[model samples]
Target: MTTDLVAAVDIGGTKVAGALVDGTGDLLHRVQGPTRARESAENVLRAVTDVVTQLTEHELWHRVVAVGIGSAGPVDARNGTVSPVNIPAWREFPLVEGVRKTTGALPINLVGDGAAIAAGEHWTGAARGRSNALCMVVSTGVGGGLIVDGRLRPGPTGNAGHIGHISVDFNGDLCPCGGRGCVERIASGTNIARYALAAGWRPAEPDGDVTAAGVAAAAAAGDPIALAAYDRSARALAAGIAATATLVEIETVVVGGGVSQAGEVLFGPLRRALGEFATLPFVRNLEVAPAQLGTDAGLVGAAAACWSDPDTFLIRGEAGN
Candidate 1:
């Protein structure tokens, strides 16, 4: 007897990744290709097709039951379209229809990359076993997804728990999303590095590295400017997480992405800031932890979405069964 599997695709500005995932959340086969983000829309679709075609060549492809996609937002899962900010060439691209032509009649499901991370974490990572949680990616830009009542909530357009764009500072910096004081503007890895540089912080080794990882090293080494940068980022993130918890009532917040790898440098200040902002009785005890799935979260989460209610699947261009 063949084991059931899901063909999972993770589409991002940098790469298009595809994998065959089993019911137990294990990756059986995988393939990846660079995303020609600056090229034409057809080129991007070709990248996705190439990944899917590689998956189809796997011997276990016969057991694949469905295809699930986790693409960078802003995505309209209801309409099977995607408009990732980093992929400027794909404005309102019909990703579902494009991928469907490669997969034949297999059912397809779509969700924001942030939501897919949440689904992956809730299924087997840090948010696992939690009935309610918020999962975030704090990389070049901040993004998030919600898990309410033990189920992944991608919302109507698959962008529900986008905590990054929420205004945490009413009069703060302007965000690319056209919102002032958005969490992404203040707390993303890029912003953290920018803050450090603007504050006169220089790298210890003169490697000319001004990324968040460099800031983390400086913070760990007791550089005041670097420490202040991380502190500000942490505070912004805390405010966003607190607001989400207060409104929706979550038990935990699982953080992923490059900046989250800072370990104590980020989490220490984050917990302190959360204590200051989340003073409410109900939200005071919210737990925050690092994600365990690492880079596989997107692929695993896409498969997890397929294993969910078939009624929630996005078949062809229509939502639900």
Candidate 2:
């Protein structure tokens, strides 16, 4: 009675993590290494491969049936390449081919990190049992993925549902992604802190702790500047989410990541702003909830991608089969 498993890799700017996930979305064994983001391309590749090597050393490696890689976007699932924004050295790096060198003959699936998170949530976390949903991460940057008609839609380039870059404010600031007034430019953790600082918000501490978390604390304490910053971010997010719901008819939006941990500080205002933007009858019932699975969504979602039909992007089998 050998169990089937997927070898999952989560590649980010800070680390390269690997795990063996069973069909039930449980991580059985894990390994990780720091991402040499500033180093040469080969160094970063080596870091990813090192994690794979460690996974292969696990006793259950023999049960692995497929390999799934969820890399920071933008990823080319069709071409099996990745060009992560934070990892400047990898411009269209052959990530699938690189990992294949170690896994050999196993089916390899590639998707953007956002899509991976969506797959995970849809498969077993917050979006489970929902036919259509949007999942987003609002941390240093905002990223998202979509589930349409009960299937993960990574798009051809694996960058669909990138709600962050969608312009919620045409007259807002320019974003690093070369887009003007993108949601991420206003709603990301970095931007939230920046907005607060620019508006004369200061930490109560003499050491000057000026982060999104710090601003969240101030907002909780009724600091006008901090509350305004979060309100602006919430408005931008609400606009983006409303636009997505109006376009795609999603029933739910599962939000996660560092900024989302602000709890009511972010969600309370977000719900209020959503009422102002999502006024259309068809989209008025949209629900937003916090994401479950925490940090493991990346790994679990990568494995979920492997179990999905390559053509339809739908889950093809029972959980943990």
Each prediction's TM-score versus the true structure:
0.94, 0.93
Which lDDT value does model 1 have at 207?
Answer: 74
Estimate, for each residue in 1-321, the C-alpha lDDT of model 1 and write its tens digit. Answer: 025788999987788999999888999998999999989999999999999999998899987878989998889988999988778888889999999998988888899899999999988899999999999999887888999999999998889898889999899888877789999999989899999999899997777679999999989989999999999999999999999999999989999999999999999999999999999999999899999999889998988876774553334226223
Query: Tens digit of lDDT per residue, candidate 2, span 24-69?
Result: 9999998888999999999999999999999988999988878888
User: What's model 1's TM-score?
Assistant: 0.94
RMSD of each: 3.0, 3.1
CA displacement after TM-score superposition, residue 173 of candidate 2 (Å):
2.4
lDDT of 1: 0.89
